[model samples]
Target: MAYDSAHGFSCDCGQTEWQVSKTAKGSQVVCYCTDCQAHLRHLDRVDLLHDGGTYIYQTTPDAVTLIKGHENLALQRLGPNGMMRYYTSCCKTPVANTLSKATLPFVGLPLKGEDPRLGPVICHAHTDKGTSGRKQTGFAAAGWGILIRAARAILSGRRASPFFTDAGEPVIHPTVLTREERRIASLRR
Candidate 1:
């Protein structure tokens, strides 16, 4: 599915194999917060978010898949930890979430590879724009966007945080990371 290399790789379904590449388009979405870094760290993605907070992207969502043994999909709530997070048991592909009242499998990585045209909406999470320290331009914009979104969301009775939404409504509760998870995250630092 990726537009890069084609080295054979294993799929959940043993019968069918997939292709992988060494080079692909890359992105770094600055998170500017610790939770953002922790999420990636929990997934051994610390290196990907090195600049304080940025989700590095390489393979398009469409390029990644669970063509076989999709039944092995297992969801874990790492945010609430005991609450909701999504991963495929077979391959641990970040699938979606199911924590809030927004029904099961609430949120997860999009299968953007399927429809390249539709990209993820940009948002600034945990941003207030009052912290004046960093100088990265895009990071600043993301922070400003976060501030604007938060103001709009709060005023309009909408969810300000974009990551965890309950029933399409912004969750008002705070996210908790376990001590063990935090300790593990420290390793990435």
Candidate 2:
């Protein structure tokens, strides 16, 4: 499908800006996973969290376009095998999360607030890890949507990633957090 519209988002310092194509095939979800929470805490961006979860638009990396301040973009991981979390060094705004490799073609952009353009939340993931006391929903639909989007992205050649190079390497090297850092970030408030 062709991109129909674009929604812009920027870091707290407004130094890093990007847009997500509306046509991106994926799901809008509120992820309450501990890792998600820890990521925000690691960046000292707990203000981005809502109801003990992070609102994320899970889509293909090809759908994201960096508008400016690419130099401020930074990558980090909670551990050696954790998903790469992208943020802006200028203001510590948690931007997106992705698989270890660009070939995976997935990007989960954390939303500061709900955007009607991305549609409604289709899933409430990892509620068991949430402090909100809400039940998980729409797991099956979200799972199928992810599989379908991933399959289509792979078939389409996984091009145009804002965070990765044409050679499938990250545009910037990732910093793996120390165990102490992870422990501190994971501490309950």
Candidate 3:
């Protein structure tokens, strides 16, 4: 039941596995962003939002390694300009969330496969961005310690992310969407 791993995590269906850095290398947080809710809604997994929050561990993209079922990784966006969300294509299980452009070296690691060792939520984010009209708590201290940690990572040059190569290109090619397709997907009821 130990979630403290320098190894990483696996999907529910065992179709995908991603290696993560040490638990100390990432930030654990809960998010209530509208986009997050919408993504869950699109996947018909609103039930995973306990207290209207999605628990995730934020880490550098370089810390992740797709150890198995690379083809099972699928991508989605809330809009033409939204962040690229990656999931298991086989079972449609979300694995990570990242920016469309690879400039940012961060990824939100979902806590689906983690043991109870993930510890307390560091902070809540975008609590004011929920679109479901269901008021959720834990917004008073959003983005609390993230800024400092991110700055440290950036300044310290710890951003040699595994998501990209030395040439600054994505390791995996996501299913890019046109504006029209993005519109339809985002507007899904």
Candidate 4:
């Protein structure tokens, strides 16, 4: 069941290009968290969600490669302590999300243009806040698998992500949301 280590992703306007891992190696998930909802709302595309959930494929930062249009990639945050949401500045297409701490090895890529061979959903996360009222099947098994694999990737010295420099700085500093903007985004949380 080996899969290709590389897969391509891009924005609607083709201003950005990304190389991410395939689903066999990456953790495929459906997230129903408030943060995900707020992220889509911030981009004015709440419609990205299917039943209030977004399909995401998790991989180490090192697994993502910015192939082109690096300058077009931008970052945004919901608040001072929110996940860093990356997008295309040209078309505002949501790209990926990462923890503010560069030491963390995980980044979640939106599965909008993924290949069908990536297979079906593995698990559901944040179901309590899921707006669609649907349950994720095999959550425990899939969640544990992801957790274990992520830990291995982190420990194996693969944290030098494409989104950050070797010195552990974001390629582009994120735009922190103001108090008013945070308040608005938090209303849905």
Candidate 5:
């Protein structure tokens, strides 16, 4: 379960865990690129960065681990024949879960259930490899919103961009989607 401090979390089994600071106050975005899709296949999850990846990107490797039941780890590559797609053996969770602490530190292990902790994914990579017409999604969707909010945030004389603000923090209250998302969803329906 997630900790209040926003720095660490322990799983129900106590075997898997991860941690990251949730002090930052920005909206988290989702990605659906080939890499992400491939990762989904490898992880055997339909929700990669969407429903997942909230805790995975925040925790330190030391804070995350599988205390037991490790015989279920699995690995495979999805994109090209040369690429490697790593995942769990039984559940096929994200490959991000099983990486060595030595090489990957910034990445986190995705949890089974929880509101993902991510902000408008400001950037994306490898757009050229998109299988569908959709590429470079979140940045555009959230760019205007982010810029508008960031501008109002800390206009402290053009320093580096800040990812948090008291004004634009996560809302515990329920809110409706914008006209755009509603329109799209309605059309799809």
Candidate 6:
């Protein structure tokens, strides 16, 4: 539950592996935004959803390090301006979401269970957009935390993101979904 220790994660097929360092700033949350749901649906990975939401650890980019299978990493977006979504082409496992530019220093790592190391869900974001019927709370706190960490990351000049190059470019090009694909994925089941 503490970021004071390292945590590792991998794709379903184990082809891609990554780790978050002990000193990384992060928070856990269950996000139920339509965009998040649509992303999973687009990948045919609805199985990753729990109670109509995805559990994620929101952290700074400098915190992550790709351990292996970098070649298998792929990128996508719901639309031209959507967040960059990373996944493993080997098995279509959702990896993380980040701003189009790595300089922003944020990554939302999709997780499976309530791994105690992630600490706790600091927020239930966009609950109104989900079918779980849960009330939304703590979003403000989470937002503040993210902003604070982001500022700190920027100030510290920590730019060693696994998802980006030293020059602040994405590790791979992104594929933007078509309008039709987005519509279909956004449809409520």
* lDDT (10s digit) by residue, model 1, range 1-189: 433453233433344333323332222233445554455566564444434444322233223333444454444334454444444445434343334443221222322122223234243334332132444445555445435534544555543222244555323343456778766764665
lDDT of 2 by residue, 1-189 (tens): 123487788888788888888677777899999899989888887888887799989898888888888999999999999998999999998788988887667889998867677889999999998877989998888878877888898887766788887787888999998999999998846
RMSD of 3: 3.8
**Model 3, span 1-189: residue lDDT tens:** 213556567777887887776644666777876677667767766666755567888767766777888878777776667777888878777888887666666788766523355556656666666443554444444344445555667787877765556787555766655666545544654
* Models sorted by TM-score, best on top: 6, 2, 4, 3, 1, 5
At residue 131, give the lDDT of candidate 4: 67
Better of 2 and 6 by TM-score: 6
- Which 10 consecutive residues of model 3 have the lowest summed lDDT? 136-145
Tens digits of per-residue lDDT for model 4 on 1-189? 112566777788887888766533666788888878777777777667766678887767767778888889889988888888899999888888988877757788886633365566677878777766776576787667657767887777666677777787778989988878766764642
Best by lDDT: 6
User: Best candidate, TM-score-wise?
Assistant: 6
lDDT of each: 0.39, 0.85, 0.67, 0.75, 0.37, 0.87
The residue pairs in collision within model 4 are: none
- Any residue pairs clashing in model 2, and if so which? none
Candidate 5, TM-score vs. the true structure? 0.39
lDDT of 6 by residue, 85-136 (tens): 9999999998989998876778999997566887878999999887789999
**lDDT of candidate 3 at residue 129, scale 0 to 100:** 60
**lDDT winner, 1 or 2:** 2
TM-score of 3: 0.74
RMSD of each: 10.4, 2.6, 3.8, 3.6, 14.7, 2.5
Kindly report which residue stretches of model 1 are placed more than 4 angstroms away from their true locations once superposed.
1-33, 47-68, 79-83, 103-116, 127-178
Ranking by lDDT: 6, 2, 4, 3, 1, 5
